[model samples]
Target: MSLVAEHVSVSIDRADLLADVSFTAAPGRVHSLIGPNGAGKSTLLGVLAGDRAPDAGRVLLRGRRLDEWPLRELARERAVLTQEHGVTFAFRSREIVEMGRHPWARTPAEDDDEREIARAMAVTDVAHLADRPVAHLSGGEKARVALARVLAQRAPVLLLDEPTAALDLRHQEDVLRLARAQAADGDAVVVVLHDLNLAAAYSDEITLLQRGRVAAHGSPAEVLTAERIEDVYGQAVEVIEHPRSGVPLVLPVR
Candidate 1:
């Protein structure tokens, strides 16, 4: 599976949010979308997930237009996890995770589905909160539960919007490692990340956005240069190679 956004641009309320934005994510690869706030990182993900339409370009899945795919068909193959999760209805953690199956599954109450839900809970380290209400969990805990929901989707393409933003350091690594494993298993994972070091460590390719355009796109070594970081982020960033993983490590200037 692969995703390609071609000359994609989005406009809202007389403002251009994304301009000629484009990138591709192939199977077994993790593509990180990095940018400053309002750079349209989340907007691009929304278009890819079919939640929003591009105003001037097209989203392609393996060269086919995304608009041609049915909603159920698309949902069965792709899953999205957004930044803020507001659970208006008070639902149990288990119930919330089980909702991921609703696209292709008719009976989420089945024993097999329950087992999958439990496995997702365990993987996200939220099994202990399974019986708790989603509204009762802490911010990080709720984020993990929401992650469990998408993981349960078992989709080939995963779109995550700053998935680790609310997580603690340990959980951040845990969740990212899991996403990497999924990509290794032949899934395509596209994540929006603010933490450049984390993006460098897990992403096979980095798509750097600046002012609604693609500033850079390539391997971390090729894209995350100190000069580029300084130009796009408007801050001094020291790019160091990880001692163990040989990936880029970004340090902020004080």
Candidate 2:
């Protein structure tokens, strides 16, 4: 289930936030979307997930236009995990997760659905908070729960916007590992990451965006050069091979 955005541009109030953006996220691969703040990373993800309509060009899912697919059908195909939001209701953690199943479901719950929810919570390390009120959880705990909701959605395409921003180093690795597993299981996973090294470690492909357009797109080895990092991020960064895993390691020179 690959997603292709062909010359897509998003404009609001006569301001072009994203211009002529185009890229293909190959199926069963983790494609990292890396850019500085206000570079339109989240806007692009919203367009890719069909949450926002592009002012120009098109978004295609497997050769079909996004508008051609029913909203519910599209929901079944892809899921988006944005920055965590406030939960006005005093819902239990399990109840919050179960909302992800609403797109394909008519009933409140199912046997398989519960198991999937539990699995997602366990993977996010939020199972301990299952019975807790969502409103009472800490920021990081809530983030994990929100991710669990997306996992319960079980879509083939997963779009994560700064997923590890609120997590500790250990949970950051945990979340990225889970995302890699989802990609390995034949899903197209696009993650917006501020940490370039983590992106390099987990992604099969990297799409670097700068000033609302693609600056580079390729494997981490191909796109994450020191020169390229400086060009896109406006900072000197050292790209070296990780001694342990052999992946590209990005070290910012302060």
Candidate 3:
């Protein structure tokens, strides 16, 4: 499935959060949204996920208008991991992950619920904490559990907002690697990322947002130039080829 946003805009209290933004998330690729704080990365993700209706323009999934899809059907088509991973009640990690299966209730896919949940928890390395209360888990653990929930959803389109924020260096790499693996499995993955290097490393395409608009959108090499980064982020930076991976490495100048 492909998710496309055409001239999407969002305004609140007279402030534009996103303006005339156009983007596409195609299957078998990882698309990263990168920008400084307040640059509308999360807002744009929300719009693409259909959680936030755009004030102007529209979002299409599989060439169908996003709003036209039924809620249950939409949930089966895409899975979202928002920035906040708060669980109000004290639910066990396993129970939380099982929530992802709710959309498949009464359907044939429900038969895979147990297997999917277990696979997701294991992939996220949260299986050991399955019986633990989500409220008692550490930040990174909680984040992983939240991710497992999204994974268990088994949707073709995955939209993640700042998924690495709470993770340590190792887990950060794990999460992005998992994203790449998902894309390799023929899923469309769109992620909001603050780490430019990580984005450059894992993303097949990138959209650089700046002040509610798209500053640049293309391959990492094309969009993550030193000059473009400095101009959009207002910081001087050096871009170099990674010694091992050959992807762009962004270094901030002091």
Candidate 4:
């Protein structure tokens, strides 16, 4: 299913967060949102995930209004990984992952839930931490465990807000790889990324936001030009093609 947002706008306490943002995240592809600080990428993500309502426009999932979907049905269709992971509970890592199954509890698929949880943990590399209390783990460890929980949900549409924010280099790449794998399996993946290079390399399409609106949206080669990056980011940057992948690599020019 596709996720589409049109003319979306958000405002809080007279502050405009997102203005007329529009984009489509199609199934079987990865769509990334990227921008400089305070560009409203996170705010826009919240709207897309139905966590926040747009003051002006609407978000649609598979052609239906987002608010129209039943909460339980929506939970089974789209999974979200937000930026914050501040649980202070003493739950084991796998136990936290099992929470994703709440939507499926006592359902017919309940029997396969254990295997799914195990697979999700192994893939996110949190299987070894299965016995560890979530509060006792490091920030990166907690991030990985949070990711495993989202994966265990096995939703067709994923909205991830900085899913790699706390990871090391290897784990960062692993997270993006997992996003790509999910998209390749015909899921719609919408991610908010701070790393322009990672966004260019992994996304089938990128939406660049400036202030509260989209600055550019298209293929990485088209949208991530040096000129656009400099204008939107307020800094001189060099956009070069990657040697192995031919994707745009954003580098600041000092």
In order, what is each prediction's RMSD in angstroms? 1.8, 1.7, 0.6, 0.9
lDDT of 2 by residue, 1-254 (tens): 78999999988898878999998988889999998888889999999988899999999997899999998888888989998557999999988888888786864544468788888989999999999999999888999999999999988999998999999999999999999999889999999999999999999999888878888999999999999889877899888999999999988897
Q: What ranges in model 1 sit over 4 Å off?
A: 106-112
Better of 3 and 4 by TM-score: 3
lDDT of 4 by residue, 1-254 (tens): 99999999998898888988888999999999999999998898888888898999999998999999999888888999999998877899989999988788778978879998999999999999999999999999999999999989988999999999999999999999999999999999999999988999899999999888999999999999999888888889998889999998889998
Full-model lDDT, candidate 1: 0.91
**To one decimal, what is the Cα RMSD in angstroms of model 1 from the true structure?**
1.8
Model 3, 137-248: lDDT tens digits are 9999999999999999999999999999999999999999999999999999999999999999999999999999999999999999999999999999999999998999
Q: What is the C-alpha lDDT of each candidate?
A: 0.91, 0.90, 0.97, 0.91
lDDT (10s digit) by residue, model 1, range 23-74 = 8889999999999999999999999988899999999986788899988778
Residue 51 displacement (Å), model 3: 0.7
Better of 1 and 3 by lDDT: 3
TM-score against native, each model = 0.96, 0.95, 0.99, 0.98
Write down the TM-score for model 3. 0.99
TM-score of 4: 0.98
- Which 10 residues in a row give candidate 2 its minimum summed lDDT? 103-112
What residue runs in model 3 are displaced by over 4 Å at the alpha carbon? Answer: none
Error of 1 at 218 (Å): 0.3
